[model samples]
Target: MREKIRSGGNAGRVFVLVAVCCAAAAMPLTFTGPAVALPSIGRTLGGSPLALNWVTNAFMLTFGSTLMAAGALADTYGRKRMFLGGLAAFGLFSLGLAFASDIVWFDILRALQGVGAAAAFSGAMASLAQEFEEGERLRAFSVVGASFGVGLAFGPIASGLVVEAFGWPAIFLLVVALAALALVLGAVFLRETRDPNAAGLDWKGAATFTLALAFLTYGILQMPDVGWTDPFVLAVLVAAVVFFFAFYRIERSVARPMLDLSLFRYPRFVGVQLLAAAPAYGFVVLLILLPVRFIGIEGMSEIAGGRMMIALSAPLLVLPIAAGLLTRWFAPAVICGTGLLLSAAGLAWLSQFPVGSQPELLVWPLLLVGIGISLPWGLMDGLAVSVVPKERAGMATGIFSTTRVAGEGVALAVVTALLSAFTQMNLGPAAGEHAAGAAQRLGTGNVAAAGSMVPSMARAAMLQAYNDAFSALLWLLSAITAATAVVVFLYLGKSADVIDGAAGEPGPLRTTVMDP
Candidate 1:
């Protein structure tokens, strides 16, 4: 009986890991797949540029903002309960997204899908902590990371093929199927786990933080269309600041805060957060922008564009695992910093290519960026909890994931706006007052629409303007990435040794090398 029980437990654990890994892959698949389908969606639904951007932004904003709250709820309730609930919600929302006839409906459904994703992801991660022990836990998390990489590696090409053969709706339908499978596995095999001493959810802190992020994203996304000095834009931006201040105050005051403000006091903790955000500017933005540039602007077929994207994402399949192995001989900080620096070089190299440059010419730079970012991507989850005490690992994980996703959403908005602004500037006096409108259209990959708006500008001239703006954007991103790399390296100095000594055992650097 004892042996039988042990065997059954092992079987259950395997199923749990499989379920969580499925959820992990589904998350990135949802993120990157829709990106590839963006042009198709826009063409089918006939939305304005801003509306189209919302399809991606809405999902990211809700997902990033609600993650901490979802984690808290998962702990207070049962992890299994939250995981199952999240999966159901996600599947339902995905179905709605598939059938959405208008862009507005699609954006709304997308936001709902993000909320579901946040809950499912938080629950899935929290459940892993319960199902596995120290060494086994590390391996479990690494498997999850690899699963995420698989999604990123193939999402674009898979999405392109699906969109071409079926339609954009098929992309969301695929997510629904994945979600359903995970949902069933989780419901049957996952154990119910909760924090026995968990405090109730911090509703106020969650609200304030969500509001702050929402307002900030909204203001930034609107900036290009309404201009910097527009009254409503100014109001929303100010509101964002106010809400952020409120969030800080609330977190400090609350007995059980969603995010512990005191964590920022630790230099290593701060460094981890910065590192979490670095990839957003350095790599994540490209996932979206490159697809638009390749298929929408450059007129590459969907399959051709997806194939090009493989160069940017394929390295993730192996580089993350390779980075994990290298950590045995190198400090996590050195590895992470070096990765960002490498990515910066790739960005700069990529900027040299013209808009219509040959696909082969662009491959090396894109591959370099992929390889560089994969190093940090693999270790960020481990580093997040490592920078804090073991007792605080759950909080630290929530904070890091939130930072990473929120940072991506904000980076996408900022880069897109900057690109539009730069394009307008590069248009010279020829486009005149219509420059902003034309730039907006061009930024969304609606080159023909932009030409229609700016009748004075030739197609060739518009493309040149966009190309110059893209180059400027890449250079700016490279500088920012390099600077961030230096700061992350400095802040994480010798802290790994300190953490290990304090714990009186192998710290996260030694044990949790690749937790995604």
Candidate 2:
């Protein structure tokens, strides 16, 4: 009877944790689903492409920077309190977006939404790591992974439905309702689990770190427009570097830093963290390109394009569960490494799009990519957290979160830059009169003329550019995946639990019971 009760309690906690992750995962997609709609949004709001880009970039910049600080705060205060507070904030801000009349207000509200999301995600992850230590950590992590899959898979569908039913504002409003529901549930059942030894919040460290990340991300995002050599961009980049330096100096001297730099000293921690970022960014690229390629270029309807995406996303939902099961027997790195390779291979296959490529041609590679994306993300996260001391688990989570988001930001800029360069180079002088004229007219906010300006030669040139971009990204993924393998083999050493007597005593992983 005692064993049965204990099992029931653990099961209930897992259910609550999964629900929290699902809600947290949905936050980012609120931005992602609208990325393609930016062209239309800009026209409606009398804004520019730059403004639309900021709509997405603003949320990402804030979310990435605050992740570490938010995790620390959760540790310092109380996880459950922070979690509910964050959910409420997220809901309110998302609701604000639903009422935003213009682009400026939309941008402002999105930024706030990001802060709230950072808090919620950081708090929930910290709670899960604390709650599930030994028997169920892998399973718990896989649930988090499923939340991600569900978020990405369903976000577009929700956005489409909302847009069709009540326009774009409805999309934001729906998220608001979901977040509000999460807030209520979190407050009702969640419990406090802050580490006993967790130190006070370091406000100075948080501010400096936020500035550092914000400046860096802003500069990177604007790179496609201004070019990296522009004085303003260069200045911001320098400022970003300086802030990071200052942040590190402050962290080292503080009693309790927002981030613990020492975690990187562990090879498994570093390797797994690095592995996490590459694939995280890689999938973002795939998601962005596949829709445009399959639907916009291939003459498929929006619904058809979205449905085709299932070819990639369906497998994403399943592979993580498989990875979780396999991790019970195999080394996390080995399983994760295999997944990375598979993803790279799938991407390589996708990079070979023929002229006037058919949507059916892409099904196999997309399905493979779906599987590839899931495994690395699932396994690497477990490996990273397991290596860290429980005292710094929050910090570890923050670091992993920060890097993955940062990687995505940097990847967007780099990929956009590379694609622009390729398009320009491939188009040559003739494209100036062909594609350039049309793009310039469209970019300048002329909808009607731009709609009629599509030229065959321009389309061909753009497709070539896309092919080059995809190829370059595949090469990048291959290099990153190979390096991850070497790092895991050489630096990461043995899997956890397999490592016998260490040079020093490792910290005990603190486990806590919480109300479901």
Candidate 3:
């Protein structure tokens, strides 16, 4: 029976999703341990704080930029085939990181790893789309969303233990092992999902999109370090706009395109896209900011901070299951709207956290935040994909994925800049003296003076940075969510509406694809 064959296909799809997701799970883990040990790393490697910042930014920029191209590639090649190839590349690059000799090499390898990650995730999603019916899709999206939270939760703890015990090299060694295993599982089980005969590959549109993303991302990253008015930044920004315009032009004219630019004509699609960006920005920045807060401000050890951070993970794991179940009884918008409100509340609650607050005391906010984050993410993604045609699923998914990553990328840069600028503004003359003292201590090789000076100004600067950063992010989340609510009411339209070109109900409500 067709139903039986579809069900059988679902099982293979779910297995592939898990395998590819496992590779995605490996990414943040590679950074977590190193991030926790940043100060120690700087001391050991003779790098400046600025240089160390690249460790995270490089990976994010590359990951965010290449996703669209990878999606195009998956749409062209068979999704399963592309996915397995990506996993192989991912494993290889991750292994390369294990042997990196310096900070530059480490950062380079991390970027390459991100490239492989983009390929794997995009291809995996493509395969998933072909495997499951619309009714089961939300659950699959939930699993994917939850995997990110799980990875974030586990990576730091795992990385901390390894880094503290055997140093940063051990972290990548673990990645190598995970990558190798993923390759084996992926090749053994995954099946091709894309129909090669269905559509022509839009290489020109894809190239333009890639260059646009790269330019835009690099420009944003430079904003933090070089300031926005710098000629190079201006040049890149202009080039990005040009390329993005060119992309639109190409997509509009092409017979078969990578992205269906007309999708933006739907206000619901636009709303979800913007709404999706906000929470992503909030969470990714939170992941980076919180650990620093726990360790630097609250005086928790790196290991202790990593463990306490697990509180955020618990709800992430559970909320997706709750969302999946609720789909049977509730509408996606209702669930998504509620999730947005919860996320806003959680973030606002987190804003109340005073400097040096205990992690245990903030558990409620974490719970709200986790639930808030999980619900809208899964629902929004489901809603967005449901609106698009199956043939254009890769492009739809890519655009959505790009928005999510771009939001996070820009958010991190903006938040970091704001945090840095705000902290410096509030540093009150003492910062200069503190920096001088630290410099002298380092100059004279007196780690004690450096340590002592590090107490007052360093601690205060850090506290101020975390405080401003979290508060700004909270407000940003609120505004973005409120805007999303407006978009939903205005453009997302009546509940249970049918997407054009799809055989479905005539309301906003749509079913998701799931594993058998």
Candidate 4:
């Protein structure tokens, strides 16, 4: 009976699994394309710094805010139900983008699309957890991770081709089609799964967290346009701080909180979450800033710009599989920390290369980053879920995924602000103000506008400004990665002979070198 109950290898089940992977890969379809299309989108909508950024930020903000709530709902109701519903809503929202005549409507539609993605992301993770057994589950997730890498590797090229052929809105239209197919296939093939013992929804905690995320993101996004001291930005920042504190308090007080406040007490769990979120932050800056240098500043085609991304995403496919096997020998701390060190090394090396340098020059470093991110990708998630009780898989998955996407949002805004501020600092105040606006546009990957805005200054100055921005971003991420590596090392210091003395078990690391 147990074997029969656990069996999920039917044709429908297999198809549904693949479909879910495809859907997850497709979710980020719009994330990269917008980097290429933002200039065009801005042309149609008017290129204020805020308008340009909101195109991406709108989706990220809503997606980050709603992910945990969606995960909690999946546990309470049905993973399959929420998964399918998310697909439907996301598809509808994507379709709506085709008719967006103004930037306001575009932002609104993008935000709604994020809501759909949150449901899809959390539900798919929980649904997969429900379907697979121990060893097989790892394989399933690896395939899913590979699918995402494939999508990212191809995204810039695909979006470039589509945007160049049609227009910017066509990108959303294409996503709508992809979402619709996933929706139909999922509805037919996937079965419902939910926690029978769920304590129920925690609306107050949800509201508090959501407000905190929104306000914080808003403040970060505004920092580029309005310096950090603007009264409105300060007020919003204070509110965000208050909401975060309130969220922690509410979760602690509530009988059924959306987030598990106790989970943070686990050093392993928090370390894993940071590991998961850190790469996302690094990747966003890479994706947004690097491509703009290629397409916008260097005058390359979108296809060429996207192809440049391949060097970064391709290693993701092979290294993760190797990393899985490596878990047997290396402690999670050693392996994950090494990955971070390598990633930081790569960024630091790449930061020194001149702007418009050959892609060949960039490939080795990019590959290192790809390898680095892959190392702890699946390993961290496995560790995170293991620390929690089995029935709360949905909650665990949601928390992990939320941290990943939310970190991407905050980092994107931070990188944008930092890039713009640094450019102004180097360029001088009177002319720097104009250069600052151009620098802001470049952060969105709008090379043409940035180039056009240079006040009769040589293009060399703009290129230098861009190089300075890129160097700042690289240095910042490198510092963060190096710091994270130290922390992760301390937390997961034990990896040998910790799991029932089993040779290859994947759980909490407890083999401290100091004890020996």
Candidate 5:
């Protein structure tokens, strides 16, 4: 009877792992799928560039901002409850997204969908911590990470095929189905868990942080359309600064803050945060930007674009696992820093090719980027908690995850604005008064629409202008990534010590219950 019970317990844990992994896979699928379908969404919905951007931006904004708060809520309220509720909300929102007719409704639903994603992801992660321990826990998280990789690896191709066949709505339908399966499994297998010492939700901090990011993203996304000096843009940009200050104040004053501001005092902790954000500018933005460049700007078929994206993302499926294995021989800092430098090289190499370069010309650089980013990606989660004291592991994890996701949203907005600015400058004499308008369209990957707005003779010039702008953007990204690599390397070097007052010792990974 005892043996049978032990075997059943193992079986139950396996089911729980499957449930959480399903939820993990769905999140990235939602994130990457829309990028592949952005052109289709724009065509069907007929929204402006700003509105179209909100399709991806809205989801990222809420998801990233809500993560910390969601993690806290799960800790206090019960992980299983939050997980199931979040899954249900995610499924409902995805359903609404599938049927959304107007771009406005679609954007609203996408934002709400992000909230659900945050809640579900935080809750699922917390529950996993409770379900597994020590070596088993590491294995479980590895499997979860692999599940996420599978989604990122195939999301573009899957979305492209779906969009080609059944339209953009089908992508959301797929998410809905996945959410449903996860919900059912979680309902059956998940056990409720909570932090007994958890404090009240930091409403002020959450509000201020959310507002700061929202204002900043809005101002940046709108700057290209309405000049930077436009009163409304300036006003929102100022508001962003003020709210960020307010968020800083709130977190410091709160007894149990969503983010422990003190963590920044530790160089290694700060380094980990920076490392988390590096991929946003270097790699994540490309997930969206490249799809648009291929299908919308270069006029490649959706299937072809998706296939090309595979070269950029497929390395993730194996490189992350390989990174973990390499840790036995090399320090995580050396591995991660070397990886970013490699990615910088890839970016610089890719810049030599024009926007419409053939897949053969682009594959190697794209593959290099995938291989480079994966090393750091695999190790970041482990590094986040390891750098801090065991007691603060949960907060460290939450803050690191928040930085990563939020940074992606911010990077996408900034890169989009920069691309438009570059394109406008390149189109100077040829486009004349229509330069700004054409630049906006081209920046958003609406090449067909942008061409129609300009003279037939100037269209060739416009395409060439876009290519130049893209090349300039890649070089800028490369430089920033390389600089970041240097900083991360120095701060996380052997001289760095754990925040727990340890001296001259690299932080070791411990079995702590992470809340996020």
Candidate 6:
């Protein structure tokens, strides 16, 4: 029987850990669902596109940068303590957003929300890695994956329902409520875990790492607005590169580093890291483009667009479980490889849909993409953790979490930049000069504003621009993802078990539990 911790024992502990971790993972993404309303929010608040872009990047930036530090502290102090604190912080910031009046203040609070998620996700996953072992550990991650799927599926639906009932602020209120629930559960049942040999805090390393990531992300986010060669963007990008170099050197010299630089030497570890980031980059495109495709081109309401997103989200609930169980027999390559191929195929096919295709036409392709992504979802998380010693769970998960979220942030910026470029190219100079605002409006499916932005341009021309941009976006993502699948399949080195650590030479696959 699964034992409950305190009242619930170990089973209860695991349950809460999974629940809390998945909620943390899924909650920020649920915020993405509100992107359906971003154009409206921008117009209503009189915010510029650049300022509104911050609204999205802010959460990703803080969440990704803070993860490693949060992991280090959780390892040094106690995972449970860090988690409770993070949950508290996340809930508070989410509450604060409900009161935010301006774009700047909203972005600031969103960053704080990312910070909280960093702590909560890293701490919660590390705690699970510590508390569970062998089969149970895999089982726990499977449940965690499933929860993520469900939560992702639910985000848009919930956003639609809540936004329909109240306003966008109500969405933050729901986040606050969910965060509070997680906090209560975590406080009551989570079992504390930390590295027994946890070393001193790496304050300098943490600062440098955070700054490097923040600047790197900032530069990337600024690209579309300021153009890539703009002096300010160039300077920040240069600083990001320098800071990253400093971070690498500091990590190498430290007696006990926040991040062990040697981890990259392992082929599987490297592959896992890439795998962590690649899918995330592609997924972020969907988050940015879908609401626009459904609402902007098709002239659907935000609620209808959200409901249609369920087509993409629902399969997440099942496919992860299927992939997890399939791992009992097949290698990660066969599972993840096949899934990636399918995902790429789905994306390529989806890209071909007519510009003004009905939401009903998207269901099959969305399902394909969802299932394809789900196949590799949990397997990767488990593999990354297994490759490290239990004591370094926080660090391992920290790296994984950072790459995934940071990839999302950078991906959004890159994809948005690409979308903007393609749209501009298709619009041509005459219409293109005036297309930016119209394109942005079109993306969110706000046809009224889009029409207003380019009254002289034909609605057909605007729709064509969005279609070309989206087609380019999806085709590019599919090719890249398919290529990544090839790399991961080959580099994973033909094994069901790729958990061999850095202390040993890479060897054959084995099902035995990995050692510290």
Per-residue CA lDDT of candidate 6, range 266-383, in tens?
6777777878886775565686578766755676776887887787778777877777789789987778878888889889989989776866788899878877887887577766
Sum up the clashes in candidate 3: 16
**Which one wins on lDDT?**
5
Tell me which residue pairs clash in candidate 4.
494-510, 494-511
Candidate 5: tens digits of C-alpha lDDT, residues 260-304:
998898889889999999999999999999999998888887888
What's model 3's overall lDDT?
A: 0.65
Model 1: residues >4 Å from true position, as ranges? 1-7, 494-516
Candidate 1, 252-316: lDDT as tens digits: 88888888887787788899999999999999999999999998899987778888888888988
Question: lDDT of each structure?
Answer: 0.87, 0.66, 0.65, 0.76, 0.89, 0.73
TM-score of candidate 3 to 2 decimals? 0.82
Deviation in angstroms for 8 in model 2? 11
lDDT of 4 at 153: 76
Global CA lDDT computed for model 6: 0.73
Per-prediction TM-score to the true structure, in the order listed: 0.95, 0.85, 0.82, 0.91, 0.95, 0.89
lDDT of 3 by residue, 1-516 (tens): 534433456476666566766776776676565666554555555444345556666667677777877876776666776787877788788778666667777777777887887887777776765655656765666666667667777777777677778876778788777667667766656555555454645778867876887677667655545654889999999999999999989989988766777878655677668666867654667676676666544556667867766766566666767776798998766777777777777778887877667667887887777777677655666566666555454456678888887567666665655555444444447655554334322322223434576665554454554466556656766666656655655555553243455513222222233232
- Positional deviation of 159 in candidate 4, in angstroms? 1.4
lDDT tens per residue, model 2, 1-516: 533433456665755675587576676467556653444455567554456556777787788778877877787777876787888888889888777779988888888988998888878876666666656765776777777777677665556555656776777777777777677655544566776676767888888888887787778656655665899999999999999999999989997777778776676677767776766555766665555445444545445656667777777677777877886788766777777677777777876765366778878887777777787766665555567665555456667778887667566555545554444455466545444433322332233433455544444555555456556656766566566656665545555543222222225555444444
lDDT-based ranking, best first? 5, 1, 4, 6, 2, 3
Roughly what TM-score does model 2 have, to 2 decimal places?
0.85
**1 against 6, candidate with superior TM-score:** 1
Give the least accurate 10-residue stretch of model 1, judged by summed lDDT.
507-516
Position 265, candidate 1: lDDT: 74
Better of 3 and 5 by lDDT: 5
lDDT of 5 at 101: 91
- Model 6 has a clash total of 10
